[model samples]
Target: MRPIGIVSILREQTPAPDRSFNFLMAAAGNNTGNLLFTHAVWEHLPGPKERIGFQFDPDKVNATCRAVVFPAANWFGAHVDLADFADRVERLDVPVTMIGLGAQDHDFTGKVDVPEGTLRFVRAVAERSRSISVRGTYTRDILARHGFRDVTVTGCPSLYQPLQPDAERRLLENAKSTLGPTLLHSTRFSARYRAFVDTPSIHLDLYRYAYRTRSDLLFQSELEEISLLVEAAKKPDIDDALIATLLDLYGAASWEELQAYLHNSARVFFDIPAWTQAMTGYGRAYGTRLHATIMALNSGVPALLVHHDSRTREVCEFADLPSLKASRAALDEDAISKSITRADFGKFLKTRGRNQETYRAFLADNGLL
Candidate 1:
């Protein structure tokens, strides 16, 4: 059987022994959360597969694989430049499928200034694919505005990573069980956009919650956090200046306390299985990171998304995942417990089962299953 070609950064589940921070960042595509979805697309696909990276030889892929699949991120935004990717996809002779493509913006009502390059890229994918699977209706609508009609709302592939008939039942059971030590998934604030974005306050609130409860906090894309993890793992001491910077950024009580927390409660993972295993120990997970929340769900742990942007909001709604707007979510144990209690797991399970069928159909139509 011909192998499927997948676009990804990490070639294997485990990192090399000599893996540097830069290599880990590359594997994660600069965000550790990326491993969740990319691995899902890689693992969920049927048959043998080869990693073809972003810049692949199209002729080689056509000769060697049945199809080339791109597990995408929030590409429909002004911040990304997709011309180079578009150029490569335009040369492919085999079928192409992009899964979980999303549009990023401040809120659902905000319009994205789609780049011409990204538009070209979408056009190229649309031409090559039977249909493109988007994360939610917002992304489908965005592409619809661009004149593409073969878009499907399949949410993220990570939601179905469990690959079990009883996955929904397990998740529902976890949601109803007694709450345990919560895992917090949050993004560190960017100082450059601190004034314009609400992420800063949200991060602070999450950080405070994690600190007060002494619950585990997971870091995704922040370079400083990654650096701290590396330094803590390798050396006797982390840089004092770096610790100070993080203290200010996360509004930590003190440098020593924060450093202790980094060594104790903070976590980052390169291996998806290891991360999934870790999540199973947690009773509940919550915060602003979408993929992280999905990871918990995939592990049969209940999670609540604190949607601060369109990318997170639309996907949560599409997947029937319980969520609260960042503006409305109070970072307290009582509030979080209340939100989780109020969640309609029955509805979520029904929607998720239907979405799973939709995803399977999408894969089958694209010749991936």
Candidate 2:
């Protein structure tokens, strides 16, 4: 099959790097989703070779690529302009672009009222006659709502992509810190459950750049993100191994000191596990990271997603998981705790497997299965 160029619209993640790319790499037993899909599509290509291009930068994409894959532009924070790029890609005529993440990034770099560059992105994509797919069913719905016809809800590329042997083990095994019942908070960690937006009262330019991205004098919005979670990690119910992670990501006197801090913060018996394993450990989790929730459900963790963005709900409901809406004061911790404990992991797994099969069938029907 011919090698396809993958234009990754990846933006800077919160201070801590999000690992969607990591999962994609795993999909092909390679290092990125671009490679995985390229390899997968290679099988159906009426070509003579068996390799794929590995360009991660959208600007530097090779001209020979007949198609490109983008997880979802909306979730990438919508920080860059793509009108020119889209025009260039459109010139390819036969180029196939995949939009995986849900609608465009809501606010530019986490800030509201800021101009959105992705709206142009959507317009460019809409001009196309054919497309690959997106991650969440909501994406498909939204596209349809927006009058887009050549799109489909293809599960997040991360689920179909392959990964390295022991990658999960390495991600978790390398982690050995002390954590209490701490929520793994990021800027958008639980954005859906609670609108953790920068309060308008906070006037630090870095803290609130008038939109999604924020930074500040003492701590960038990113660092505060780390601080809040680290603070929560001190609970007795938290995992002991994740403490060090907090310390490093946030800042601590030491692992021991971090543990002491968490103890003081409101300790919960939090056994932080791997991204996927956390679902298994918690028996249930409320998360904003789409893949984390997906992994949790796949791991049999009865996860109630805090749909920070559309993808979470789109993916969750697509899998038949009863995801809840995001509201700062909406969730009752007591109620959530009870439901999680009572959730039948086995039943959830069966449901997920059925969804998986149906999704595979969809892919196959599209010649991508």
Best by lDDT: 1
C-alpha lDDT of residue 88 in model 1: 89
lDDT of each structure?
Answer: 0.80, 0.39
Could you give candidate 2's per-residue lDDT for residues 1-369 as a string of tens digits?
434444442211221234342332223322112332333333333334212333333444444444444444343233445455555554444444554545544321323221234444555655542554666655665556455666656655444423234434332332232222313222322122222333421122112221121111111123222343433222223234444434433335476654344344321111212233432334344434454444444443344455545545566566555455455313344555544444344443455556556546544543332
Show model 2 residue runs off by greater than 4 Å: 9-66, 73-81, 104-129, 135-138, 159-186, 189-284, 327-334, 342-351, 354-358, 361-369
User: Per-residue alpha-carbon lDDT of model 1 for 1-369, expressed as tens digits?
Assistant: 888889887833454446565666766787878888888888788789989888899888888888899999998999998999898899998898999999999867757898899999999999999999999999899888889889999998888786344556777776766657888987763323344233356867787678777789998876665566763223223466555555665568797787788779988887887887787678888899998888877676778999988998899899888888888888877788778777777777688889999999999998888
Each candidate: how many clashes? 0, 50
- Rate residue 96 of model 2 by lDDT: 43
Model 1 residue runs over 4 Å out of place are: 11-17, 163-170, 174-179, 189-200, 231-242
List pairs with backbone clashes in candidate 1: none
